[model samples]
Target: MIDKVFPTPDEALHDVFDGATIMFGGFVTAGTPTNLILALQRRGTKGITGIANNIGLGDKLDVLCEQRQLAKMIATFAIRASGARQSLFEEQYRRGEVELELVPQGTFVERIRAAGAGIGGFLTRTGLGTLVQEGKQIVNVDGVDYLLEKPLRADFALIKAFKADRLGNLVYRGAGRNFNPAMATAADVVIAEVEHLVETGELDPETIGTPGVYVDRVVQCEPVPVRWYG
Candidate 1:
């Protein structure tokens, strides 16, 4: 089999096209593929639909929004985390220039999981009787009504991990593990960036969060400086 490792982040993302749907693995920027995102911003691909926990907290996804590279965002949290400071995504959304799909966190991840599992959709009451329920089909099961949330698959998935074997098995650190595994399975192409690249047998089989089967490409990237007591 051909090696899954790539020499650089841009090369890993070389096949990503304009108007592609992408899932970014990160929660509050802790496990984001910042380098790959930077390369993507430089690539100038437009009309991108991004699926992530948020637009970012002054991090990776925000820069993409500033460039207007992202045409739409399907996320649990968007600009609300910024408090008084609005992100570029919010500005574009306010002007009716970008499409936004605000989903509850649980439902958002569940939708992606459904896609990966080959399930049509799932029923959830998370957004019941709220604006989030709009346009969604409601089904009553056992006398309880729930809204149908469609699966959320993507064309490309950009994931981050602390360590990876040459074969692409991944090991995420702490909170960095949040969305990477699920996103990996939900995309047609998954490129994982790792801080540590080791031989194929280095990673303990049981500790690998994402197996090589789900990763198409792997690249080594500079590690993010973590602040523990901020």
Candidate 2:
């Protein structure tokens, strides 16, 4: 018999070490794995390189920034458009305490998908003729320039889901599905924090966003109110 369910978030993340690259699945607070993030915060691992769509923006990930646990961030949005809502990540970035890699949102998701698909790299015109192309290889095809973007992979992926079975198949809800399925496929060890845990075969096959094969562990957590600011 195969079982991927874990009793707690901390146990599911026990193997995560210092200086590991991690993928965080979410768009702002939607689908964010707050329980797993909280567990990681409690574990106190440092020098993490986190890949996410946004660093803070009301997500619980800011606590990692406040704790100085992150060494670098590879994200699409790390700073707010207005200065009024400054995140700890932005403050650390401005102070030069942490490194930041600003990737275009489309490119970010594609890169992660490429990793799961086992592609070396891809060429795209998304960043051509801009600072985004700086330090990146550019290839010309038929007089058109395209920047080469490499795949993004991680040691661990922390994702959220609406429901998960003991076997680890995942079903997501609404905007909460954002990034969770893709991140589940792109990491070596994928841990899902779910609102409900059911027996195997409880989830409809058609509704499954992430297959059990891609998930290493599942942890059930209560639905918490989304916190937009710390």
Candidate 3:
């Protein structure tokens, strides 16, 4: 029953320094740690490498990109469809202020998982014949083509949860759970922000999606500003 709650988002992320590689959870902004992202924005930490499903839409995770705090982004989707907030990410890329590495969604998740599991490398058929194999090593297994993919690890993992126990056990609701769980195990440290915080025994053991062992810190966040996406 370790109480991991911090007084504020800034306090929870106190040790996060500049030039950190961060794995951010949420699929297209549904389960993003809005408060934590805001805290990082306010803290003004620079040279961050963010790994996520999408860079977020509109002002969702735009704080970092807008502030130029991000040095690079590793994600499945790098740009928005329409042109509203496009300037934020686009300007950075145009000026060579930020670097972006796009990967297939399935490859993205598996790479994180592989790193977390301590596997050296994995062979996948997902990107065997496309541009993904261009700069990568390709291997043949039983006459089938597969790419030898490297694992991805990070310095910190920022995740959002629907509910979290005092011990840092977490449960994510709906699609919010996407990259959070895999990011949880793949980083050196994990900071979780949740809407609800409960006592240690409040959550059922079988229901906990992320155990306390992988999470190092927790903070209770206010309702995030939900725009058209929510």
Candidate 4:
């Protein structure tokens, strides 16, 4: 039996180095991997390229961006809306201090999924003739033009889950399931921060969303109260 469990967040993420690309799992802050993010932030590894739905809702709590830790962010939303708190990422990006790749929401997720699935790239009409198609290839099949969107693999994936068995199988609760599963398969090292760390057989096989084989490390974290809206 493999012991994927780690004693602490630092030990689990000790190997993460500078200039590594990381995929963050969450829908804004709802199911964010706050614990793992904290560990990485403390490590102070620089030149990171973060892939996420958003940087943060312009809050001081976003240490990764606030501390100038990321060299770039490949996300759907890095800038906040009017009257929203402004995050440090926006400040840096606007001053030409950092890089930003703003992908269309659907295209961004699909790219990550494609990487995990081992596909080179996929063609989509989502960004045809738009800024998203600028440097990408354009393929025409029949009469429709599709933009070639590349896969988005990462060196590490930090995900928050509800429960994880010793074998690394994970069960995410509610909204946490959003990007965790996909990012799990897309990264070389997947360190999961879960609320509950159970023994192998303690978990019901049917409830697992991310199989253990895809996860390399698991750390226990306290589950926070969360509510979802449709």
Candidate 5:
């Protein structure tokens, strides 16, 4: 039985270094690993590359971009109407201080999962009709255009969950079940931050979103402060 538990978010994320590539779990405000994200920001490590579904949701991840700790961002979208205000992201992109790699939401998840599974790459028709196909190998499968998309692996995966056991089995609550599971599988090291921490076997087997095998560390997150994006 592995303890795999940490009292603080900072401890769970202690070994993250500068210039590392990280995959953050979330789909906007839902299931975002905010505690670990904040700890990373507070660490002030620079030149980081992050992959997530989106980059805003009130006070959530916007802080990272504002501090310039991020060197590049790969995601589907940056919040324009809501969340942490994409002003920082837009400013950085325009100045060329930060690079952005836009990806389709579904493809992003698949790429990460493929990386985790040790697969080289897979073909997809998601970007067949647009610029997403540019610079990528194209193949015809059953007379349909498919683009070759590479797997996405990360040095660290920051995942959030509604609950977890000391052994690192995770259970996500409702909308929080978006990208956290896939991100968890795709990282060399997985750090999980949960709102509620329980003893081993406390969580039902069927309810676990991510198994302990993928998780390396666990942290109990404190209540997040409320911030309005509107």
Candidate 6:
């Protein structure tokens, strides 16, 4: 019997060490793996490099920022547009306590996807004439300039799912599916925090967003309230 289910988030993430690069699956607050983030917080591991679409912004990942556990962040959204609500990550970044790699949204996802697909890097014109092209290799093809973006991989990926089978086939709901599937494939270890855990055959094959092979562990957790939505 191949069972990937773990009793708790802590146990599922027991092997996560200090100075690990972790990919957090979410788009703002949606699909954020709150339980796993809490578990990692409890463990108090430091020097983490987190890759996410956004930092804090009502997501439980702010707790890590508050603890100064993150050494750096590679994300698309790390600060507020209006600068009204200052996130812990933004504060730390402004104070020079942590490093930030601000990547364009499309380029960010494509980098992670490239890692999963075994691609070395890609050339795109998305940021050809912007700061994003600085310090990056420039390639010219047909008299057009493109920036070379490297693949982004992580030591572990913490993802949230609507449901998962004991074997770890994941099914996501609505916006919750944002980065989970792609992150799952781009990490060395992938743990899923799901609302429901079902039997192996219960999940419909067509509905599975991340297959069991990509998932190393699965833990059931109660749905975290979406406070940002209120």
Segments of candidate 3 deviating more than 4 angstroms: 80-87, 228-230
Write candidate 5's Cα lDDT for 123-211 as tens digits.
89898879888899998888987899999999999988989898999999998888889888998999988999999977899889899
Tens digits of per-residue lDDT for model 1 on 68-87?
89888998887663366677
C-alpha local distance difference test of each model: 0.87, 0.91, 0.86, 0.84, 0.84, 0.91
- Residue 46 lDDT in candidate 6: 99
Top TM-score prediction, candidate number: 6
Q: Rank the candidates by lDDT, best first.
A: 6, 2, 1, 3, 5, 4
In model 5, which range of ten residues has the least summed lDDT? 78-87
By summed lDDT, the worst window of 10 consecutive residues in model 4 runs over 221-230
Clashing pairs in 5: 58-83
lDDT per residue for candidate 2 within 97-196, as digits (tens), equals 9999999998999899999989998889998878899999988889988899999999999999999999999999999988888899899999999999
| Per-model RMSD to reference | 2.1, 1.5, 1.8, 2.5, 2.1, 1.3
Better of 3 and 6 by lDDT: 6
For model 5, how many clashes?
A: 1
lDDT of 6 by residue, 34-84 (tens): 999999999999999999998877688889976899999999988776757
Point out where model 1 deviates above 4 Å: 224-230
**Candidate 5 segments exceeding 4 Å error:** 79-85, 226-230
TM-score, per-candidate, Cα-based = 0.94, 0.96, 0.94, 0.93, 0.93, 0.96
**Model 2 misplaced regions, further than 4 Å:** none
- On the 0 to 100 scale, the lDDT of residue 197 in model 5 is 91
